[model samples]
Target chain A: MTPKVSRFLRDAAPATPCLVVDVDRVAENYGRLKAAMPLARIYYAVKANPAAPILGRLVDMQSCFDAASLEEVRLCLDAGARPEDISFGNTVKKESAIQAAYAAGVRMFAFDSEPELRKLARSAPGAKVYCRILVGNVGAEWPLSKKFGCEVEMARDLMVMARDLGLDPYGISFHVGSQQTRTAAYEAAIARVAMLFTDLKDAGINLRMANLGGGYPVRYRAEVPEIDAFGAAIMGAMVEHFGNALPEILIEPGRFIVGDAGVLSAEVVLVSRKEQDDPVRWVYLDIGRFGGLAETEGEAIKYAFRTPHDGGAEGPVTIAGPTCDSTDTLYEKSNYRLPLALDCGDRVELLSTGAYVTTYASQGFNGFAPLAEHYI
Target chain B: MTPKVSRFLRDAAPATPCLVVDVDRVAENYGRLKAAMPLARIYYAVKANPAAPILGRLVDMQSCFDAASLEEVRLCLDAGARPEDISFGNTVKKESAIQAAYAAGVRMFAFDSEPELRKLARSAPGAKVYCRILVGNVGAEWPLSKKFGCEVEMARDLMVMARDLGLDPYGISFHVGSQQTRTAAYEAAIARVAMLFTDLKDAGINLRMANLGGGYPVRYRAEVPEIDAFGAAIMGAMVEHFGNALPEILIEPGRFIVGDAGVLSAEVVLVSRKEQDDPVRWVYLDIGRFGGLAETEGEAIKYAFRTPHDGGAEGPVTIAGPTCDSTDTLYEKSNYRLPLALDCGDRVELLSTGAYVTTYASQGFNGFAPLAEHYI
Candidate 1:
């Protein structure tokens, strides 16, 4: 076991199936990002974890926030973040939420559609708004897929419309995608943004900022580049494309900052073989899809798991969450392997689960409580 | 618009993105099931909704419950259901949950593995237990796969082991699958149970009950056979296979009991074409997968939608929930069509959504609250 897991097991272990977030790791991650991208302002995405302690740690680091909803904005505000330091990042929002965010002193918001722009005009007039442009999500694990951003032409129209509606078209934003692994994807998305900036300038809309929305990949089972590599690429791209006219760079990093900070200690509920001769062992854990870890959707994102007998002879294993729902199975087709001696009550630590797990947990599905979160 | 939609709009138009359940329809559904299957005991699956009002209505009708957890048992008990009338239906359960259920006077439980059987033997000693046999789920919309049930030989061993552990091996149970459409699936599963019963009897264990676990189909976009057809098929299979020595029949229906009784009123958040010439309109609703309606997993279950302009010329539309998550898109690939005139603020009612929507909702993802549920 790693020292972090050992410390968690010794000092702060809650009941099994609980998320234990190490605040120290979060601070290290924040420091790394800040050191790498001194020119870029970090707006920590609150939707990733929304844990108050994590937010407070970011607040202590003098970090800004990218809030998705009124509740997230409130969470950041409660965590001591100034209103000017937070950006309402979700483009599609309820009118009431926009009003509530505006009322709470938030001035920066993101919008993509005319309807949302209209809603912003009504509720958040003169707010510094950013139009999210659709850049294809080719290399990202969690693709946004036309959900948030609009086409560049539509974005141009929306930017002009924002100005006409009396909202400041302050910047342009685009998500390369969540858990974006390829640095080339950033280069491509930045190129698209650069082209858009030129087009908007020709249209008499001088964008003041460029929000490089979150998609900074974190290492799980696969290797990822250091935060410095990403910062260098982004910085190099801005210099090559904009030269002396570089827009103020802002980033909304969700998974990159918190992903490695959390560890989920889950206990094996049962260990059984389907058939006597079957080689595969099915290890059911106390936590599953509904128990937070919804990111295991389609079993696409493979999390690094640490068992006590990690170096022992390994055998094929199917991991499942402790729920009646069949879709709660975490690894069946993924060729997941674990120690053969692992039995019921054996604890396993899921690494890099700090982001997206707790916030996406369903409320008491099949009588299973949401995954308990504990900050260390 | 359908008459139901018109009535809902005219009489009880709730806030957008709310679940409205018709108690009268629930009663009618219960009556229909009772009328069709007079011999089988109706154990309403609490995991389906677990709404207090729905449970109260079931209690008034003297319906038994198939609780998945201790909380579900408590919900039923709070709804005035007798402990003797409730069965702990989930096979994989926490030891504490089993103890809690036993303490709450629930004697009937289900198990499929030796580990679980051992847990039950310790916590719920002398309780009436059933071994779930793996039945193929070829025709199920939501296939259970291998998440549940054991093979016949392992089940036989587990049954004998249950008796050895001093727990009553009360019965054999198998689920054809959830949302099973083919009547032959039930017939085949019942035949398998019959052979198991004969084998168990030969082993000197007299099984006292046969639980044809819930998979009763409900009308969505497709036509489904009435409850009577399923009842007739089950009865015929039992009679044909077991003759006069039939065990007591029990069914735990979740979706069938509640699916048709609920309607979801979701307002259009936006209607937009990604490309100006694109033919398909993307209709965003205030509700999405996290908002409930997670049954739309894989787009396998298609819900019938009724717009105010239902009879107007229709165009292919992509349905999405009002969340920033890309996976929240409901029907992008399912040939879902809506009225071309459907615009922002236009209300659309999702029919037959009563059973699994409310209880499965995420706590709050992307700042959106859980789908508000109202019973009329």
Candidate 2:
């Protein structure tokens, strides 16, 4: 936990299963990212944590936004972000959303298919549109599947068609994947996008932007390359691929900007064993999958935990959430270990949970209230 | 879709993505279950769908309740269910929740461990408690893992410990699984629990109740055995084990009570292919996993669809929700096929989604509003 969040937890003593975010840490991370990649414009991915405080802080920092839906676009606007500073980033959108965003003066949008392009042409006339191209996600923890982007050849045709349909063929974007650990993934995607930029230029569509979509890594239970390494690797790839004619660079980072800036405080409700002699204890927390530690699905995102008994004698544990459903069980195969002294009513903080915990929570699954959020 | 739901959808064209439930169908389901298992008391599982209308109608039928949390117990009480008619059924619960329910006149609870039993002893004092045991979950679509229950020996010990702590060791309980497809699954679990029932009786605890927890399946893309099969198998096992001195039988049916009583109608947001000639089309809808089709996490619980062009020429397809996250992609490997004529803005209904849909929804992931609900 950041010092501010630690102080808040110590002083305020909020209820269990609540997230406390340090807004100052968010600003610091934003500054560090800006320092690492000065040439690229940052568009805070609002889907990560769209709490008003986070949005207002990013808006005050003059950071742009990447909105996944029309409601998110309005959230940014409500936070005093200019419509031009917000990009409608989702490729699959309702035509009504497109018309609404266009009327709201949001000119920039993203699309990948002919139908979506047609919707854009009809709804948001002459809007600057970026085509999301499919990229390999070999090294990412949460590899985003082929749900959003189109094949490279299809994107090439779509960009050409964009200009024909009277929309500005603004750019090409690709996501290596979310929580991408390997810089080589970004480099590979950048090379593929550069070749596409050349192909589009030869086809008489002068694209002026390249959106390297969000996949920046955050430290959880393991180490990841620093933001400086990603910065250097990305710039090196750009220089190698495009020489001095690099297009305007854009990075839509949801996880990186605020991922490590908050901590989720939960209480241990029960600590027991399935068998009397079983070595491993089952630790049940007050919150669960439905309460929004959703990244724990399949034990994909291994979040580090800090218990009140940290540094004491430890033993292997199988962690689960408080819901009655079996799917709410987390960290069974991952071999989680907690301090031996950890018991019911003891507070534990899950570190680096700032990004995706709040909005991902269910309305009130199993009649448990939604996870609360506090921004200090 | 049921004729009632179909008529409501056509006559009162609500928003694109909303759940329209036929409360009359819920009443009919209650009657059917009563007919199928006349010897067993039906405790309506409120976690499935705790809407006021469903609860009120079930209350009218003189149904008891199996609540997963204190808020659910309160929901039952608010719906005119007496506290004596409700069971705090979750094995894992907070002491505060137990105290709250006890204060609110709840007397029965479930536990699988000594620690939880101790909490009940302290918070609920003389409350009657049931111990849940681990049982194999074969032939279950959503196999509830070994997260909630305990070993037979452990449950036996925990019940004794409950009696020692001044609480009533009322009975034993076990869940075969959710969406359980086979009658044999219940028979196998009954055999396991029956042996323990004899063991506990020899130990001087005359437990009076047996909770066969909910797992009843609903027909989705495939058919399941009729409720009569489960009822017969369960009765046969009980009679074979207990002879002439059968205990009071209780079965919690969540999905069976309401799963087929509702329909979720969503608008197709976009329909496209990764490649121009690709055979599989990716159909995006306004509702997705985060929007409460969470049963599709591992492509389990395959819900049937009703499209406007249902009988038209069909082609292979993958379905996804409107959220921008790749995890929002619902069905990719389930061999889902939709009509070739299905296109953007077309409305489709997912049938048998009455249970576990509304409350499981996120707090508006990706800025899309939560799936609306209407009961007629």
Candidate 3:
């Protein structure tokens, strides 16, 4: 945990099952990322954690935003962001959302299909549009594959169609997937985008931007390559493919900017075993999958935990949330182990949970209050 | 869809991506369950969908409630349910919640571990307590295994310990699983509970209740055993084991009581394909896994769809929610097919979604509003 967050927990002692975020850590992460890639403009993906404090800090950093919905665009605006600094990033958007966002003075938008392109043409007239192309999600824990971006041929035609339909064909975008590990994945995706840029140029549409859609990794029970490595790989590929005439580069990072900035403090509600001699104890926490640990589904995004009994002898454990549903069990097959001294009512902190935790909480599943959040 | 909901939709034309529940269908389902199991008391599982309209109607039907949290206990009370008729059924609970529920005059509680049982004994003095036993969840589409319940021997000992702690050792409870498809699953669980009942009786605890927890099926995309068949199998097993000395049989049903009573109406946001020659279309809906169809995780609950052009030519489709996260993709490997004519802005209905949909909605992921709800 960050010293600021730990200090807050020691003094405030908030109620069980709450998220405590160190705001300064967010600024530090942003600074480090900027140092890693000096030329690339950062667009903070607001869908990760749209808390006002975090957004306000990013606004002070002069960072632009990538909004997944119109409401997110308004959140950026509400946080003192200029309208020109936001992009409507999701390809699948309602026409009304497009109209509202356009009316709000956000000019940049994303589209992968002809229908979405048409919606943008009708609602967001004269807006800058980017075509997303499909890419392989190699070595990603959470792959963002076929649910999104279209094929290269379709994207090539769409950018040309965008120019003909009174829109600015501004860029090409691709994501190697969320929680992407290997830096080579980004290089491969960039090569694909470069090929698309060449094809679109031949089709009479010279796309001037390259959006390296975010898949940056965070430390979560495993070692990942440093951000400097990704920065080096991206710059190397740009020179190799674009002959030093690199397009205006944009990076939409969410997890890397704020993942390690927060910790989820939850209490052990109960500790039990199925049998007297069973080796694995089921550690039930007040916070669960429905309680905002939604990323723990599939036991992917494994989170490192801190307990009061750290450094003590530990045993095999099946961690679970207090919810009655079997799927609420967080880590059964992931070889999770907990301190044997742990018991009910002991406070435990799930580390590096700043991103994608708060917003995914159910409104009130099983009548448990929505997870409480505190920004330091 | 129920004629009541469909007629309401036709007349009212409520906004898309909302739920339309027929309160009358809840009453009819309650009536059928009561008729099928005349000897047992029905405790509506409030965690399924805690909308006030559904709870108030179930209260008017003289239905008892199984609450998973203390807030749910208050909800039942607000809906006119007597404290004496309600049971706090979740195995994992905080001590403060136990104290509050006991102060609210709730007398029946459930526990599976010594820690939770001790908390209940201290907080809800002299309350009737039941121990949950681990049971196989074979043949269940959504299994409730290895999470909440304890070993049978452990349950027998806990019941004896309850009597020693000055609490009433009331009963034994087990859930076969949610969306249970086989009658034999219930029979197998009952056989386990019957053995525990016999062991507790031998220890002079005189366990008088057999809490056959809810696992009754709701027909989604596939045919499930009739409710009448479940009633026959349960009663037949009770007779075979107890031999005219059947204990107070109590059934806690949630999904079966309400799953088929509501339909989720959502609008198609976008429809596109990865490649020009790819036969499978990706249908993006305004409502998705985070929106409330959380049962779609792992494609466990296959919801049947009703569209405007159901009779048209059908083709394979990959259905997904309109979120940037790839995990929001719902059905890809399940062979989901839709009308070839389906396109953006078309309305579709997901059937048998009344039970668990509303409570599972994320507060607001990606700046989208929580799923809207309506009752008639």
Candidate 4:
């Protein structure tokens, strides 16, 4: 067991399994992305972390909002994002959801099929449409291309149908995939969308925007392409294909906006020996599946068990959570040093959990309390 | 794409991401276990799905609640579980938490340490203690024995300390591990606990219960053991080892109680081609890292993706959720078939999601909503 330890942020008091967003880091991330995509309008994906305070700050940063559901739109709209400044990007939407989006004043939406276009025409009269396409992925194993994006043939049909309905289907959009490891995917995707743009223009539709759907990969475990270099490659492709005819650019980067800005802080509860012939030990933390890194089951990143403090680093101890469930383990092993002895009430901080952490918390146990926000 | 279809208990109405438990299935599950272990006292591990109504139902099943925290104790109390019926099973606990558990009227608690004994004595002096033992795991890659249970040698010492403190240390407890695949582990654990009974008696401490702990596996996939048979083996071991001296038995069963009873119904929003040169497709559902399934990164469990209305099942599709993050995928690849083509707004049900589903959901895009509870 590691000895008694403390976290710098919780030296005063501790809140277990809560997310703390470093507001300064978030602003810096937004600033860096905004600077690189000077010609393209950036929209923060609210699905990452939609805290009202975070939403308000992003709005202040002049970033538009991207929502996936009616409830998401409502939350962003309530947080004071202009209705038109919001983009309802979920392609497979309900009729009532489409009508609600229309009533909520969402002007721009993405469509991946002829049925989607037809439904939009019936529900929202003359909504501006962007034909979302399944431009072949570069190398990332993203599921979006198969799940939501329309094929090239279907994209053409949807675009023509939008024109027939007298709706200004003024854009071409394709998300390469999230956490894209290579920049070539974006380049290839942009080239494909460019071809679609030319085809749409030949059909007498004046496109106004080229939406490079957001899947700007954050370098989670490994190095990814730089935003500037990747953007430059895509922009160069847009200029080569459409020249002056290329529309204004829009990108919907979700994780790139806020992923690294948040951290989940938990406390150590007990340190005990593992079962069997193995000589391993364990340090139980307060945060488990209910915390931000819940997707890792009990363990998220390999380094999730990596503790920052050397003094608190104890012997090789597997970490578990406070949940009574058998699967409530946090780490199978630890690489970092832990305190030689840790009693109850010690803290462990889970790093780099800002993007999808707090928003995915289950409120089923003890009324869900929002993580306390501290802006520095 | 399979033609639009439907399935049992779901309609055209969109089902939310997290799994919904059939109250009937839950009641039946409890009834089956009760009938099998007629002499054993079941302690429902509330960490699986600690909603108030779920706890209330368990109370009616006559099962006591096993809580890890003071808050969980309060939750069981709020759901009308008598304090005496609540067991604080967390080995390493806070002083305030101990007081809270005591105040909440919990009488039985698990003790893991020499220091913890003094703390529990100062806070919950009247509470009965269960000396948790580190009886090495049966056959698990990772076990809870690493984090909570006391060493076998320490268990003897702690029992002696409990006696010196004038506290009625009721029994010894040990959890094999979650999703434990070995039945022999239970037999071995019972043998160790039986041995400990003699050790504690030699120390002049009379104990009356043996909590073999809860790591009873659930059939998340087709490969798990039958619950009925496993129950028989465990009971047989208890009778064999303890003979007439078998203390009142207690077991904490978490996922095994509710995992199979729940299904997460989601909407299939988009289906597109995987961009690779090879022909592959992606089926995106409206679920993600924080939605219905919480531990995609840990263990790989097959999700039975079915469309509502009997949509004819299609090719092997990789299923993903709507979160813009790359890691938000649900199933890497599946051989699922539906009745018809799934269009926009078509529903997909992810089965066997009852255990760690909403308990880990964070309201990322929209806030968490309550699940519907229907009586059998």
Tens-digit lDDT track for model 4 on B84-106?
A: 88888877676878887787677
Could you say which candidate leads in DockQ? 2
What fraction of the true Cα-Cα contacts (under 8 Å, chains A to B) does candidate 4 also have?
0.34
User: Per-candidate DockQ versus the true complex?
Assistant: 0.64, 0.90, 0.87, 0.30
C-alpha RMSD between model 3 and the true structure: 1.0
lDDT for each of the candidates?
A: 0.86, 0.92, 0.92, 0.69
Evaluate model 2: give its lDDT: 0.92
TM-score of chain A of 4: 0.84
TM for chain B in all models?
Answer: 0.97, 0.99, 0.99, 0.87
Measured by C-alpha RMSD in angstroms, how accurate is candidate 4?
5.8
CAPRI category for model 3: high
* Native contact fraction (fnat) of model 3: 0.88
Error of 4 at A1 (Å): 28
Model 2 alpha-carbon drift over 4 Å, by segment: none
Error of 1 at B158 (Å): 1.8
Backbone atom clashes (below 3 Å) for every candidate: 0, 0, 0, 54
Off by over 4 Å in 1: A1-8, B1-13
Per-residue accuracy of model 1 over B1-376 as CA lDDT, tens digit each = 2355447756877787888888777878889998898999999988988988999999999999999878899999999999999999887777888898899899999888888899998999899999888888888898887888888889888888899999999999888889998878888888889888889889999999999988999989999887898899889998999898979999989899889888888888788776657798888889888888788879988999988898999999889988778888899888999998998778888988898888678888877777888877
Model 1 chain A poorest 10 in a row by lDDT: A1-10
